[model samples]
Target: MATIYESKTTEIKPFTYRTLLITPDENSEFSIKHSRQQPKHTKKVVLLNLVGRTSTDDIDSYESLEQANLFPLAHHIDNDKQEYEQYSKGLVQHFLFLIELQRLWKSEYDELIDLPRSSRGKFSFRKSDKDTHQYREAQIKALLEPIDPSQAIARTTATEYIGVVVKFYSFQIRNGYKFNKTPFEYEVVSIQYQGDSTSIGAYLGKDVHIKDLRLNLGKSRGNEGGALSSSHKNLNPITNREWQAVRNIPTNTSQVIKNVAG
Candidate 1:
């Protein structure tokens, strides 16, 4: 069901931040060994919240995701320019564990318009959007399956997240690490889903150095920094694997695909 949006005095748009997800060891001290992705420092993190519980109806909900996208899903390896043509496929894609942003926006696309009054975008939600977003992340178990590929290069692909026009912001890796490069944040502005590029596109004008955003958000660590909001208040951030609620997902993760279709 649609979430009722009663215009609030404080309009909060989602903001991206770089964070690390680290788990504590038996000693109760943060250790690199206690992680999923097992980054040398910490795993990348993102902000996600449960939508609700899932039931059999989620299958239909998954099928319904296509209607939300402006793109069709796939394109030839070779396609022409017009540069603007990339977004034709539609927004939603072959997502096993994907779902709409329970807390992200719709009007974010209007940022280019420069309206006098600022407001949060109207997010697209399925009638079952709430029920769908829930527990579905369990599919990450499927998403994390070991790919046969030995080495991987992390890069942004256009076919992913088509309907959002993002404003880029830059930040560097936390202090020092094995690798060092600035990561940029993409703020969704409009839903004119377009072609993908490693770069952010030249809409800002000529001479703009377009950089492809290849990054992921990570879970937050306590003592590492920041306090949790009231919701996660009692939850101990230092506890090992505290963030991981669903453990030991099936090797055959069809459940995830069947569940989190969007």
Candidate 2:
């Protein structure tokens, strides 16, 4: 008899934040609807930042502010239930990404991952030898690099995730939840949208300047001919054989259709 060997694969679970749906008490001031007859119960999405915490019940005051900053957007009057829920979920994912980057930094440098709290108890990241905007940005990019090329995050998704984190920091700054040294450095640049000549901003001679992150992720200068370089270096059009195979798929057969769909 021959001995048989079995290969075991371990699955890595992604980090996630906790959310609670709670109905306010009768005396509570929380109310989304202003109708004469309010519903018996109204639910609210509470996003808790449990980045490195061991217990969900161990949230502090500073963490409360971090969680509360997302409440306005999560329960915005303009957004419906589904829309608000999505926003909450996206915010949680973005925060988790930052937490992952922080873990990478801590493992590499053997130092505290998060910004230090000030004497007044406000979040602040004062410039230091170990902590600087450039150093942090480099660490973030390094962590974001894909270990397996096939499992890489899409450029658009990466951009959106970072944008959400930047916006969250901006909101915290505006609400006095954080002081000096934001998570990322940003610049205001006027963006001209193509094929929007009749837009109000264009007509009114107003340049719409938005906060742009300075992480320098996918930046490229034009070539000598002044043409912008292509970012999709590995992308290629399908060959005739590939196209024919796709076109000749036997969808009428149940097994074939199932295989194609999968």
Candidate 3:
């Protein structure tokens, strides 16, 4: 019999991993509302950069201070605790996904290109580097078209993540965070509606022109559940027979009810 050889593969982990850390914010109004005498404690989500040297302490240091502002923006979006946490989680996931993509792109570029390790620092390309640019574009396209369907993130989830990131950037811009070049592009799209349409846009003479921000990632696939989709299952009133059946069900206090009635 021929000898069989088994090869072992080593997993490559990134040097720096960005993660979300939920901490208590004493400045939050909700915390103050709950406690009159003691200091208030509210949920404050921070994005921490692991395995990296920075001027500030790990607790205060983040991948981006603007990204850390997501917690306050999330509260403004919704005051509810659960909603705030969900929004924070989505935003964190978006940032982490981008970081992973950057790491992978750089790794691939380094392997293909004949350059000094020091020169291949960033995962960006100049206009003259046509081949490098094409490679990056191809990588982005591949991300949209998943090779393994089962491993891919759900369309709805991807949409939520992108939306959260967009909202965070918008918030930063509104607060006077100037970017040398805007991260995304925008185009004015005119939407036409019928005169008899129930939409609010119908009142604006059927032609509604709005500036739609075009994100780097392509449009999300699949339908996001709407009010109508949620309400598809119509509920009907229970009959008297069904109500009596529910009342007749045995309980620990059945004898107590009978004695009280008697």
- How does each model score on lDDT? 0.27, 0.42, 0.41
Better of 1 and 2 by lDDT: 2
Model 3 worst lDDT run, 10 consecutive residues: 2-11
Q: Which ten residues in a row have the lowest lDDT in candidate 2?
A: 2-11
Which consecutive 10 residues in model 1 have the weakest lDDT in total? 70-79
Q: 74-148 in candidate 3: lDDT tens per residue? A: 453234332244555665454445544445555567555645422211222333232223333433443566676
lDDT of 2 by residue, 1-262 (tens): 2122111112122222233344566898554534443222224444443422223433232233344445543344323232334444445565444444455554566335655323322323543321224333533554366565455544455555555555556666556665545544444455445447566554333344355453556543322221122322355685676555455666543322221111
C-alpha RMSD values across all candidates: 25.4, 12.5, 16.5
**Residue 247 alpha-carbon offset, candidate 1, angstroms:** 44
Question: By the lDDT metric, which is better: model 2 or model 3?
Answer: 2
TM-score of every model?
Answer: 0.18, 0.44, 0.39
Ranking by TM-score: 2, 3, 1
lDDT by residue (1-262, candidate 1, tens digit) is 4332211111112322233467787899985433243222212211112223234323221122222221111121112112222232211121212333323344344667744332222222332232222212222222344243232211123313222322101211221221221222223244333445655863432233343332233443322112212224335443435333223235333232221211
Ranking of candidates on lDDT, top first: 2, 3, 1
> Which segments of candidate 3 are over 4 A away from where they belong?
1-66, 70-82, 105-144, 186-262
List candidate 2 stretches off by more than 4 Å.
Answer: 1-46, 51-75, 78-81, 84-90, 97-144, 148-151, 173-178, 182-207, 214-239, 250-262
Off by over 4 Å in 1: 1-54, 57-69, 72-212, 216-262
* lDDT for model 3: 0.41
